[model samples]
Target: MINDIALGPQNREVKQYLSRSTRDSVLGDLGKVLAPQIKGRGTLQSTFDKHCIKDSSSHRKYWTEESFFNHVRGSYSTNVISGATIALLWKSFYFYAYHPFPLDLHRDAQIDFDAFIRATLLIVSQCDELLGTRELDWYWRQDTAFFRKASFVRMFRSIAAPDHKSRSQQQVDMTSSLSDAMDVLVMIGPQFMHAMPSEPQLESVARKLFVEGPPVAGGQVVRREDLSALIRLLLRLRLKERIWGTRCHFGNLVEAESGEEYLTEVLVDTLTGDNSGQIVTFQQLTGAIDLIPNLLLRFQQLWAVLFQPSDAIDKTKPQVNEMELNSIGGIVSLFVPPIDDDSAGILRFNQRDTRLTLEATTQVSPDSLDTSMSRLSRGISDDSSAYVVIFTDDASTSNTVIGAFFPIPSKTTHMIFQIQPRFRILRWEKTELSRLNLIKPDAKASLSEFAASEGSLSSNNAPYWIGNPLEQGAGLWVDPNKGTATLINTVGGCYTEMPSVGGTSNTGENWDVTIQQARMHIFTVRGSGDRKG
Candidate 1:
């Protein structure tokens, strides 16, 4: 049944090459032909006639954003064009026909689309924009998974219901056109949680899509599938913003890497399991742990757990089930501090020493521990508790702690902490320091006397400041008169400190101070052994 042309290898290669090149040339010509038709002027047939003629392919102009929008509009309005044909045209031009532009052009498209929506809103006198022709078409063509015809109908109803009694014919016409377009777009398209939306416009759209109930259309009640689709879209958009929105300020740690890669590594760390029995070092875990506090700041609720050497120390061996851990102690116990702090008034786990002591004395069956941990795990998965964990070796330093939004091996050598979908860790920039209350009026006190006070020690009795005595710019200072402690910068004369309350003085000669540094971290207990009375 083979054709004579396919009998020879050389003939087959020649035919394949010709087919690819001819396809490319045809698409390029199509782009030039359709570019002018999208401007809402010529019909698709006229544009095809003007440039798609056999000899008219000589002039190959690049497709611009304006032209792309124009084509999208014109193709949708063309009565002669089928949805499948329009989709094919878009795929051809978008992938191979159009001149290559910067990836930022996609962003520019979004901006232009947004502006178009705003203009449409003005015409309709509605605060919310309609999910019209352009939006539905773009969504269907760009990401068909998230496109739902029912959702589009519901959104249209919400935006089309005008508050004004006197509706203009132009507004009526626009709505009618968009409605027809959406009907076709959704018919051709396939169907597909949350940090709050940061952008005002996104927030408004999200509220409309998720919070507001879907409006009835054609005397039919809104379907659950439509509501579900809207929710999915809202969550996806918010998550997209979180991951790609900003750089995470990891103090000096994020040097030489793009924020996007840094985020990717953190996420990888969280999901990775270390089967090797080697201890996970501080340096290895620092980058991933550095993101937890920022994540907490972004998403208020975080579930966390701590694992010690004795609790499944050999991570190489399959670990206990999460449900097992939950049965013994609920996951909430991890965040709820056994002993409350009055001054700082923040819920925190016991000190490293106390935790170590409890682990040594406590005796529990592995089965019991597993059951407890598993229940705790369920709470986290069910959104009843936060979902993050911490791990520490028996001989680890007491000064610093690490936390993550995922479970890690008990005795893993290297851990990869991935940023969870619900949270985003942004780079804490120096400019943002002004927003925090880190400075106060100076009190009359000698720096030497303040350094000698008991307040110089941290709550855990660790040395509050660590630096070289011989270095002038690298030491700790406490202003006794001002009731504040400062860490002298190693590279600069500036010091960073928490401002003291009620230390203000009206003296014209008051010392002016500025904050130079800050750090944020999240911590939690691995086991409830320490909580036993």
Candidate 2:
């Protein structure tokens, strides 16, 4: 019956509908026409020869882009395209069985539809692992569900016949090859939405596909990368669907404490803009979060660390602070109370934000060592010097010779700093000005007297911590690998070999920052609440 499916001439129809230059290029390459002999060698072979997949010589030439369209197109009428689409969905669903995703997601791993479908089928046919077996079975059963829904009938009804006069001609416009494939998915959605096979039905399909082959042994193993890719695809589609509406709601906020500090956040849509949202102060955010899922737990951990108060804030400076929240990978949604009187009440957690505190940290050591500590702040320096200030051993790290201050001071301050690694301190510039002013807390000192004293208001000495090419830390470090400064940072508190911030390496192994002259930019993932800055 696929032969009965009357898709128009392949070449003419395909060129007219190519969505991107990449697709057109692929088709152009296919048009040049290569012999089967060249195509046959692309198949991968196993070392032990146990899984040597001998390329079916006939199928080898079909690797071209045009060939792909022809295969699916030819299979259109016979229910083969629908069947294959279901197969793809089944295979895609296997990702959920082995690798769970956020419930709100709409796309599967392997953002590339062809690659995803091909990989799923190949894995089902070859992989003997548990994950593989479960995947194959999952897809096979999904195929059966399509039959129960009678989706083909529904699709045909909606589609216009070639010569028929119809009012809804726009509805069945499968003019492009891509449209044809999408049509198949549109028809197959109902089957995928159904429950998995019952015992009897499972037995039925198992017997039918027995000739095709058995499933892999351990089921499907979905890796984190796969999950990330899948989530990205779904996010793109959700954006396409315009699912993100204004007035997003972040679910309940969860408060967590690390040592003496507290960090908190409520699950909100990842797309919400911090600058655009309602400005909620630190006082309002203290008891706002609610714990719901394991995802929220992981999210809370990251938020706690990212929001920890930093030592870089100078109580002297005033600036309009903003907060940015991003998912580790994709845009995820959280439920919040409905905003209006709509019958169906649910919250969309797109990018939503409120005013919150920005925290920074600074580390201090004894001045005898001539060592510098990196301070995290909102400001930048071209020389990449650490903002180091020497004090009489009594002042808090917050007191400095030069600092950014505000007209109206706030109770707490957060400053951030980035360290540019070099082997030694190339130079140093220091200045001391007497009669510096002070802005000490709970002080009655007049403006001029406060400026003259050595108290918190004093700004007599100005020192710039310059990069020392020879000065190195005790930990691991490296300069640019392949001309790029090598930098290192941890992931989820776990060490993994990643590209050197300034170097090039395949393995993401951790490198010591002090030992190597690598100019690495380090990022800390953390969260913070309003109190105890």
C-alpha TM-scores of all predictions: 0.17, 0.19
Please report, in order, the local distance difference test score of every candidate based on alpha carbons: 0.24, 0.21
Question: 30-113, model 2: which lDDT tens digit per residue?
Answer: 222211111111221111122212247733221222222333343233222233433333333233222211011223222222
Give the winner by lDDT. 1
- Per-residue alpha-carbon lDDT of candidate 1 for residues 1-533, written as tens digits (9 for 90 to 100): 25444445544443343333322242233233223212222222343332221324754333334444454444234333334333332322332111111011232222222222222221111111112123222322333212223222223232121233334533543343333333222221222101111234222332232223322122122222222222221111111001100111111000121133223322333312123122222112222223321221111110001001112112323223322212001211212222112111001211211111011101223221121221222223322112233222121221211222322222111111212221222121222211001111123332233323423223112222212223233333323222333333333322221111112212222122211121112122343222223
Minimum summed lDDT over a 10-residue window in model 2 is located at: 236-245
Off by over 4 Å in 2: 1-243, 246-515, 520-533
